[model samples]
Target: MNRFGKGLLVAALVGVVGMAFRVSWNALRDVATATGADETAAFLYPFVVDGLMALALVATLVLTGDARRFALRVLAAYTLASLVLNYVHGLVPQLHDEVVDWGRLADWDPANWALVLLATSLPVGSIYFGSDLVAKVLHHRPIETPTTTPNQDESAETYVNRSTADLGVSAPAPITPAPAAVALPAGPGVSLVKSTDRVPVGAVAAESTRPRRATGRVPEAARSSRPVRTAEELLIEARKVTADWSDRELTAEGIRKAVHTSPAKARVLRDTLRAERAAAREASKQAARAAGPGEAAA
Candidate 1:
């Protein structure tokens, strides 16, 4: 509920408790006087009755799950009971001997006026106390702290290494260096040779001089005449070409011109780029799904 509604409920409860206290005190005092009880007993009688009432209220609060509704019902019942008892007591001949006119405020004695004010305030007091009690009881929870040992001071790296060792992870192999490229002689008619073949000095192996089969098919060795570019090399070239081109200029023609390759190869590079992007997106989605539950628990 809103703050204003809660305030009103509190005020009403306070009034009810006050009225019950007044009624309990008056009843006890009358009984004590009739039995010739001493001054101390008379003074402490109301507290006993109020304590019992408090215990009864707490018992009711604990037993019921819906405390707000229970408190409201208690406040209403007590207010009605107090009103009925007040009406009945006013009818008694002995009680009416010094009755004041409630309608005439100026004619009312100060003591009598104070009694009336206290009686009116009882319901408000009852509502406030009842609602407050229920709120405290229902919302209260015990706090839990993590248990730890004084001797436990392990670092994260130690834990990770231990876990990996237990899982039987093998040591990584040492990396080997790649062989250096062969340098060709720098002169007229001295051409660069493919890595797979050896050419003698002062010999010119022209492309047109290469022999072809009777079936007009090139030999496997002849097919590897030009060095084949690796996937990494193709991807690097594609990236450089895309970086230089605007969004509107990213067509097959632009890619061919930028990378100095044919249209078919440019198309192949674009398809590879799209496949890599799709794989990256899938990996990100899988990572998010894996971490979702852990994040929510935290």
Candidate 2:
């Protein structure tokens, strides 16, 4: 509802509740007095009733989801209700036997004025309860921050060492360089052997010196295989070969050769080129019409 509508509703509720509390308080006080209750109990009866009303208001504020708005409404309603009840209590001769004229409030005893102040202050003091209720209603659970464990803080080397110890495995020894080889006396037709491999050095040297030849023919497997070409690459190559040729002179075979694509792709490229040319011609005609007769003639 709009703000005005909500305000009207709250005002109506406050009127109804205030009237109900007034009636109930009078009835309870009468019953307590008639039942031979002590003077102290009868005297404190109205305060008890007001306290219960305040408690109910606090509970309503606490339970509602929109506690903030409800708390404000409750405060306004309680203030209005308190003022109305206080005025009624002051005016009614049966309720307040002491006759203090409205214009003579300044002349009234300090104790009587103090009592009036306390009664009005009761509802205002409940403002704190409303605030507490709102806080409780709208409170949210705190988010937990992420924390690192001891293991996560350890270095890679430390982790590896710990793991090896747990598994009862020893780490491998560090690698050491071998001693330099001593030269032996050269014998006829003897070849030097390297420590890295068993293969003769002469064979590797011979392979490196051999000449390489280029073959124009593709391998049987490669010739049968079809390579993937993007639509952009095919269109680019098709445009290049067909740039100097008219739409009628362009052929699927020429496009396939220019882009090295399959027959099906070549046919698609041919159709695309025809569509593009048709579109261009249509655009030129539209531009000429828009330019008018004088511009066309020029």
Candidate 3:
């Protein structure tokens, strides 16, 4: 429906409900006053009765399954309660001036006692059943799970290691250098010998040949200083950091962290990498055109 149409409908609904409450309001108040309610209690009586009926009616529309059925029962009960109060109001023209005479049932007074109890107990029932209806509606409310922020250090590592693999570029894990060899003291019955040394014939006759020491040791690398890392090398490693990046934007700070380089050098490498990638993409498009339909397109 159009906005104006909805507004008109809503205004009409309000007017109708207002007029209904105005009419029922007097009858319910009379019932409350006749049932020995005080001034304040009698004034609020219509709202407690009619309000619960309206609330339950709306609850039936919102609620589902068993909850809907429960709301429907509440609506019916409150509706019946209102009907009884209005019936009592119709019978009694002078509510407080004269006591209601129940004809033959006057001695037992069960019907009058029941109507008074129902009228007075409505507020209590509204509090209980209204709260229950609200609880049922709340049960269907969608729960929002609070999200936590990622750890900064872990995020950086994730961007470097995992994001790189996603970007189709990855650097191998750093290789640990082999530990240096240690020299051991020569043991008893062990002898150091040259390849040229010969064993005597009597030595072969012994129960066991004496253990021989190493003729020579494996020589360690002469140069011990760390090798210098080139810009190209840092750019290659830094590819892992920027490759999986959605924006595909390279930053000097990110490059510096990835390859552990100076900020100035990182900036230089960043520009070089961007240019290289751009050129590579251009080459691919050109190659795709050249390849035509004969071979797999670039």
Candidate 4:
């Protein structure tokens, strides 16, 4: 509904509640007076009943679980009590003129005693019960539950495969390095071993010359960082690395890994090392052929 319609509805509700309260207030006052209240006491008695009803109604809306049910019970009891008093007021036209005579009912001892007790004690009851209910409701707390499931920990393999799938590439299988191939960051000075499997791209391995410590800490020397070596310096290191090689099948990839240089620079370094090895082999073969005649003559 629009604001104007809402405003009109609220105004209408206020008018209706006010009219209802005005009608019942006098009836409640008459019931108090008939139940043995003095003139001054009767005047303020309507608030005791009506005020508790209001509090109970509001509490019923605010509370939950057992507290809500208690509030509802309080509201229903006060509402019924108010209805009974209002009904009594309607039965006697003399009550409207403030000339109610309770002398006949007062002669019945038990009935009059109960009526007086109910009316006099309700204000004190309203004070304690109504205040306690409101306090309990105000202090109430609720446990909140999570609405969504939390994410689980991701494994390195799953992360790698997912990342590769996103890039539209096949996930590479794990491979062992070739016998002559060196691991990336080989400048750290690890022992080289012979293995027949090819090392796939972005793969690396490490083997220590010393046995691993069972204490689970890497040796201090193994934890050292790689020193910054230039291209020429790395080529010098690479020549020393390949000097004990069994064949001339050294790859640029392996050279780049061993020395931590660019692919282009590794290719140049590999070509230079291969040509040097080839020339040395040729000179050795020529020397062996030339010395064969001299050895035979001797």
Among these predicted structures, which one has the highest TM-score?
4
If both were scored by lDDT, which would come out higher, candidate 1 or candidate 4? Answer: 4
Off by over 4 Å in 3: 96-108, 142-298
- Model 1 has an lDDT value of 0.58
Error of 1 at 32 (Å): 2.6
- How do all models score by TM-score? 0.27, 0.27, 0.45, 0.47
TM-score ranking, high to low: 4, 3, 1, 2
lDDT of 3 by residue, 38-123 (tens): 77987888999999988999898888788899999999999998987787677666664545442221234797667767876889
Reference-based TM-score, model 2 = 0.27
Sequence-dependent TM-score of model 1 = 0.27
Candidate 2 per-residue lDDT, tens place, 204-243, comes to: 2112222335558877777756656699878987887788
List, residue by residue over 180-219, the lDDT tens digit for candidate 1.
5578567997766555455344544333322333557777
Residue 239 lDDT, candidate 2, scale 0-100: 86
Highest lDDT, which number? Answer: 4
Task: Give residue 175's lDDT in candidate 3 (0 to 100).
Answer: 48
Candidate 1, 208: how far from true, in Å? 54
Residue pairs in collision within model 3: none
lDDT of 4 at 178: 52
Give the true-structure RMSD of model 1: 27.3
Q: For residues 112-168, what per-residue lDDT tens digits would candidate 4 score against the true structure?
A: 576566666788888888888879788987657766444423455656765555556
